[model samples]
Target: MIEAFDLFSVEQVAFGTGRWEQLGGFARRLGSRSLLVTNAGDPGDGGLVDRTLRHLEQSGVAATCFRQRGEPRVEDVERAVAAAREQGCDLVVALGGGSAIDAGKAVAGLLTNGGSVLDYMEVIGQGRKLTRPATPWIAVPTTAGTGAEVTRNAVIGCPEKRFKASLRSELLLPRIALIDPSLAVGVPPHVTACSGMDALCQLIESFTSNRAQPLTDAWALHGIRLAARALPRAVAAGDDVEARTQMALAAVISGVALTNVGLGAVHGFAAPAGANYPIPHGAVCARLLPPVIEANVAALHAEDRDHPGLAKYAEIGRALTGTCDAASDAIEAGIGCLNDLVDQLQIPPLRQFGLTPEGFADLVSLARKASSMRYNPVTLSDAALTEILQKAW
Candidate 1:
């Protein structure tokens, strides 16, 4: 009954062991000149970036690098745009985590239709549309989370707005996203848990979001199963290549699903929390997952004792915990997962990022405005949101 609206999009996928070898060919086809965007010298990631550039060189493409030393900042985007324009590079390749990928999305969007990045930023700016397709951008994920490579929207946090939003458009998708799990193997345990949760959240939220479509549901369910199995293995032992490959698949699947479907409460607050505090994005999401699920379940029950959504929660429960016919067990499954993950990795709460009880008031207010919340089954009030924060805290 839900297949009324037909959607079609393009995503060039190159994935496997040694898939990095294909980067040169994709870059050459995109353009001779390439902008390799990355975070500043993550000692672990720096060498990989160099090798990717060499691949481009071998492919007969010239590469100019724009290093993001910190998180992706407005100035970084500005400079990347300038570098790409100055070099006349027709292709943008993001090589690291979400920061570089988002920066590349911004650069590609602005490359064709020249304007301030703010103009295109959803909610914070004029919310202008990206009418033209950005230059051919290739996403190479070096991390196992965020799935920024497959998403059509780029999340940019704006401190001035006290939140973040996506630079969303069909045109913003990468021409090709290269998923080589070998590149994600060296991730530290803490980063792995956090990013893995982020991937997990994307899949779970996409599956449950009000905007989910059939195609998106396929990605979400597959991503959910793969992540649930592989994330723990990847965290327990980082060098497991098969686990990493499955995780890579999960992240990419979640990314594509979130790109096509949407997300729920956990992500609705991630940008606000990340913008206001130094807390990592995935950490914020990881902490919020259980309470948000409980809240959603409680809200659903309150709205209707017999809603289909309640049954969906039961479905999620069986998927996560293998529990039978227990709708509220989904909330339990979410809690068990979060607690097990946190204890395994011991992720810190918002307070570690300096969000005292006093700061949370403002954070809740800011989080309330984030557009991602619109997809949540129930729109949480200030008090309700604070309750979730307090529980996570």
Candidate 2:
């Protein structure tokens, strides 16, 4: 049987050591007036807000900066949209981590579309399809994680609803993705671990996803190999340019793959876990990935011995460990390798992050409702889900 799928990515990707130097020229082509969104706590840190403004100024483009304080929220998008509208900005440059890029994607969509961010969020909002083209947005990632630079959806956390949802549309894809691995040179080791694990999980899950297609599979496999070799090195020495560049490439590949083929239980659970706790999205993914992989393998074998994802896991095991084994044996070896990586990264358990058994019911229910859950190779029962959570705990 033939499977059909669609691929979406940013229009232009400029990836190299100092590609950020081209920002001014690119901004001029996009628009004369721009809005810049960044999550940097300080103006001088990896937060390139001031530098981005200088680039736009040098290009003769008028620019305004909105510094996002934390994770993207519904309120952040609302405020950014209003800022863009008031300043009459014509372009948006998101230069930071995932939060800034996600927020910029939302603001760009809402700026031209003329609606609140809630009008298009999944599960909790009207889920209206966005029809208008977004204002041209350029994404410059300061981190090597959360390929929001290329993905088509912005995750927004709504405090009032106590849930995190995504504002999605093809229009939300950025006009350009400018990835400079040098920007990640000084990122803290802890942040590196969490983000790197998220990138790795994205690659592994997408490769074995129910929606996996030949195109995504190719990307995922390559990304998995890169991440396996680079993530540890990057985490150990943040200044290692070679490792950082590989991790960045792996992250972008994972993002493109997940956007097309979808993710699995780790992200499915992370969505709700992140909303209910103060944990970072990447941290949530890191904590849950090993258990989710183990559970998926067990469930697939117990329920349907011939499910193809089982073999895919073996392939993943081979890709990660560079060891050849039978599919069944490889799956166990892969799980062990993943666990080793998790410990090496020092990904804390859910308990340390405030996920208690009392919260299990709501977490499981919300996890199931997440759109990502649909792509898991097997439908996990409530009991199975509980077991996975407990194991992670």
Candidate 3:
């Protein structure tokens, strides 16, 4: 059976040095009552939040704030939706990193539909479809990663299931995407690296996904090129406008690619690790990327060069690093880039999250059950999965 690929896009992107001021008019255009969704208790975001609130208030829009701190769980979305309903908000405005935006997506999705957030959750819950229209939503992305502003999927982990899943629907795509480079300026070095890797991985994984389409491939290849040139520089110097601008664009383009083409093993494995471990999603992906690449390449090569995933690997390597040396060298360089980012950012290991080899022993099962794993070009054995974990370790 043929599966059709759907292309969704940003309604508007406001990107520049100081573009938050533009929010006043746009926020007014959306609705009079705005539920301002923000990151929970980040001291740095307070001033930005204040600026946004001032703009909304001056525009005569009544606003309520929903502060979400960590990666939003199902309950967080429910709580925010309830607050929005109580406040009788007409719109949901997400303003922060991917987590905050994801929270807002969930809140917007549930406000009109009035269903359990869990009922529409991925893997864990009933996995019900959301047929109703979500509340009007404007996404304001403060970070240069995830491109959650434009993505149709919102990944929320369910602790009860011990596996992560995404709430994906065309209806859940934000009504508008507000991308402001200035918003990413003061992000910490660690965040810059992690988020940047998340962008980098999306570009690579999407370009290489089994279901890649011509449009998404164009987006991913270009995203890969931008990431190679800008991500490291952005991590080193947050205030560098040129680098920041490119990475910011890369984030959105990569989001566009992943939304249309989907992702592969890196995401497949990371979701479970995220659900089970304390490690952040980007870090886990960054750690796993090279090993997974190498494993897939090796699995392809050692089989008399008859492996199926080779073309995707070749394209991704050439796109990101440019000029495939040898397949092994290309694979190694990919791994090297990840290590360089980890070293440059000082990201910790899986063990830091209490994921010992024994802990990871259980990951094979978790990894096997993950949805993203289904997209991998080759079907890896349990032993291959364990090997990838060991290499990542």
Candidate 4:
């Protein structure tokens, strides 16, 4: 018998090759003025940002642009929120990678809630719940990763505290998630590889999470299969529309699955590591994926042989390798496939990002406190977590 579960997702999603053209209409429905959030490095120059501006103008919707430099910092959200309020903007549209979307999400949420980001953020703040609906927001992803468009939480980095945490609330879910695979074309190969691997890791980890439910399991497996088949193609040929579309869909599915069922050790470690290091979030997840999988499988085998995650890992292995072998062999084969993919994608080791043995204790201690870790398939000891970190290093 299946256990009870809950699923949360965006209110609406518009996905296709030409869906970007509908952004203006969507924004107009929400408000006449919008705050357009994009990457700091995007110089317009007739690029995607310029195109978006044109779309909003054509629909008679005025926009003020806000560029987010990196991951959503608490101050970034504050600045954007102030800009939106100053401009009397009623709608928020984020058009870039995960950072831009997360920044926009936080801005939208705080616009109505009327407080600092710290008031609603988890782990490093007051953890207050958002009592009001966020300003209407739309998410347009320029990369096929993160699925931040549909998620309800925004990750905000606070450099002063040397940690990252989430500002979470159901109100943060976007009014519309507009995904156009054509926008992902021309993304650098390295970015594609890292983002694709992040999607894959989320799928695998969510599938094996203790919170896995029937719907999430289905979404996870389907996404895992799509990522396994499309990631290499997307990395090899950035202009491949089919590969980009598949990856985009897989990423959205991953976001949905993880939002409902939660994630495991990879994300657990990614939280603290990303906050403390200069490494990119996707790259950190890519480097740790294989080692975390191995550690989880080992811990499960040694402790709870009958845990459902063991079979789930075998299923993931089959998805990755297209193999119909015994569970043990398939699990190993799946892990081998991940290692090979990491090598093929040229994902750098954790050590390359300045992580050393001396820091393992702190990382493990922080990881234990990560909300994602509670959803791991098995309870891993400090020694096991340390070993995984060392191997990734």
lDDT of each: 0.81, 0.88, 0.81, 0.90
Largest lDDT belongs to which candidate?
Answer: 4
User: Which should have the higher TM-score, number 1 or number 3?
Assistant: 1
Best by TM-score: 4
Per-residue lDDT value at 2 in model 1? 69
**What are the per-residue Cα lDDT tens digits for candidate 1 across 197-222?**
89988888878888878887776777
Tens digits of lDDT, candidate 3, 1-393 = 445777777666666767777787888888889999998334336587877777899988888888897888888888898899898899999999999998899888888777888788767778899998788899988888898988888888778878778888888888778887878888887888888888988888887787877788887888888887787888888898788889888999988888877888888889889988888888888788878877777766776584546766766666667776666566566667667766666767666777888876689888877778887766777888888888777
Across 254-336, the per-residue lDDT of candidate 2 in tens digits comes to: 88998888898998998888888989888888878878888888898897798777889899988888889999888888888
Q: Evaluate candidate 3 by giving its C-alpha RMSD to the native, one decimal.
A: 2.4
Model 4, range 192-278, lDDT digits (tens) per residue? 998888889989988998888999899889999999999999999999999999999999998898888888988999999998988
lDDT for predicted candidate 4 compared with the true structure: 0.90
- Model 3, residue 293: displacement in angstroms? 0.5
Error (Å) of candidate 1 at residue 273 is 0.6
Of the candidates numbered 2 and 4, which has the greater lDDT value?
Answer: 4
In candidate 3, stretches whose alpha carbon ends up further than 4 angstroms from where it belongs are 1-5, 40-46, 302-308, 324-329
Off by over 4 Å in 2: 44-47
Error of 2 at 19 (Å): 0.4
* Candidate 1 TM-score, C-alpha based: 0.95
Better of 1 and 4 by TM-score: 4
* Ranking of models by TM-score: 4, 2, 1, 3
